[model samples]
Target: MTPEPTLAALLARLDRVEAHQAVADLMSSYINACDLAKDIDRIVEHFTPDAVWEGVGRNIEFGTWQGREAIAANFRGVQERQPFTYHYLTNQEIRVADDALSATGRWLCFEPSTIREGTLPVWIGLAYDNTFVRDGDQWFISHLAVDTLFATPYDKGWGVEMFTPVTAPKEPSHA
Candidate 1:
């Protein structure tokens, strides 16, 4: 015979589920604001006051921005460079803490952009490792690390060279 769950256990399970869903929704909202909504204010609202946003590697613009103002500037730069952008996220992995106060996620992104005042469209492949914090029942992005794997014109796909990291060893690995 199985025993029913205690009220405390049931509430704890619910809290975890709610936190996970909230974090997922937060991610979707930020991405939609960046592309579909194209609302800078909405994008800014997703981050914590002391959030940090950083980009690594050669595939995309690289910068380390801290605080809400700096993060807003980064998004503004994106808007300036691309009049219209579409971002697709896949392979998402999200983990919420047992206490339901924080979470982390990893995602792969394919972004295509219409360059401002230009006819050419560019595409980029990126990986996002993000962290979220729960503040008074609301979740906000606390850190965003974006690693761009490849960035090229729509007509030109990534080649072998794109797959090779700039800092690779001189000799091939045996493994």
Candidate 2:
């Protein structure tokens, strides 16, 4: 009979790889949360309690919130003010360090935030640079840094392509 791989051995093997799937999962949550554009709490569940989220749009926010609550509030502001636009994430890369518990990922994002009046209000090129940590058996976003690579005013008439709605995942029943 073959013996099972030891935890030490498994971790060592993982360290040699970039753990791209883990990074992809992180971005999946990001993309899913962005797509909802309604249920505001998804943003809170996506982040850890002390997560640091920043971007070109964080400041001059509609209002301020702190800790995980801050992220939820941010989502609220986002859904309330910004018209729904599809965000496309692509060209992602993850670099896993020798420490299996830590990793970093980079991805390019294109999205337009528009207003109800159909005015494209803001255009942004965002880079999601991440620091990850596993919470028990599950992975959660420990620290997220959003670098706005570029931003410009979206013309009033400009419209971006959007994917049609499918059955989106529901948030956990418990808050």
Candidate 3:
């Protein structure tokens, strides 16, 4: 015969479940702010004051940004370069610490972006490794490391070319 779970065990399980959901929600909110709202303030609010955002692999050119202000600047640069983007995240795995004060998460991202003043369509594949710290009841990203799998033009695809040529749009003619 099986015994019922103790009240303390049930509460612990509930806390873990809630923590997982909170972390997932935070990621979703961040993506929405970047993709849909394009609100730099909203995006930066997801991170801790001293958070570190770093890009690796094929995206090493992005470099690293530490602190909320730096991260906001990085996002602003991205906004200018890619005016439109849709980010989709999948295969998310989040593990809450036993103490429930911190967590780690991994996600795979597929992003379709329009760049060069909507003249170029590009596809970006990325892997994200993130750490979150809990402050009271709220959680904020402490470190976010993204590795780019590929960033290829839609027409050429990554199989043919690893990345699309990034060029500024031609200026309007004054005649």
lDDT of each: 0.78, 0.59, 0.86
How far out, in Å, is residue 98 in model 3?
Answer: 0.7
After TM-score superposition, the amount by which residue 112's alpha carbon in candidate 2 deviates from its true location, in angstroms, is 3.1
Lowest lDDT sum, 10 consecutive residues, model 3, at 166-175
Ranking by TM-score: 3, 1, 2
Q: Which candidate number has the best TM-score?
A: 3
lDDT of 2 by residue, 1-175 (tens): 9999999988788654635576578678767777764556765676678776554233221222336866665565556556565678888888766765667777888877564333446565667777777665455676676655544556422244222111111331112
TM-score of each: 0.84, 0.68, 0.88
Which pairs of residues clash in candidate 1, taking residues 3 or more apart in a chain or in different chains?
Answer: none
* Predicted candidate 1, C-alpha RMSD: 7.6
**Model 3 per-residue lDDT tens digits across residues 1-175:** 8899999989988888888999999999999999999999999999999998887666434577889988888787778888999999999999999888899999999999987767789998889999999999999999999887878999999889887665432331111
Better of 1 and 2 by TM-score: 1
lDDT of 3 at 47: 98
Which candidate, 1 or 2, would have the higher lDDT against the true structure? 1
Clashing pairs in 3: none
How far residue 32's Cα lies from its native spot in candidate 2, in Å, is: 1.2
lDDT assessment of candidate 3: 0.86
Q: What RMSD value applies to candidate 3?
A: 6.3
Top model by lDDT, which number? 3
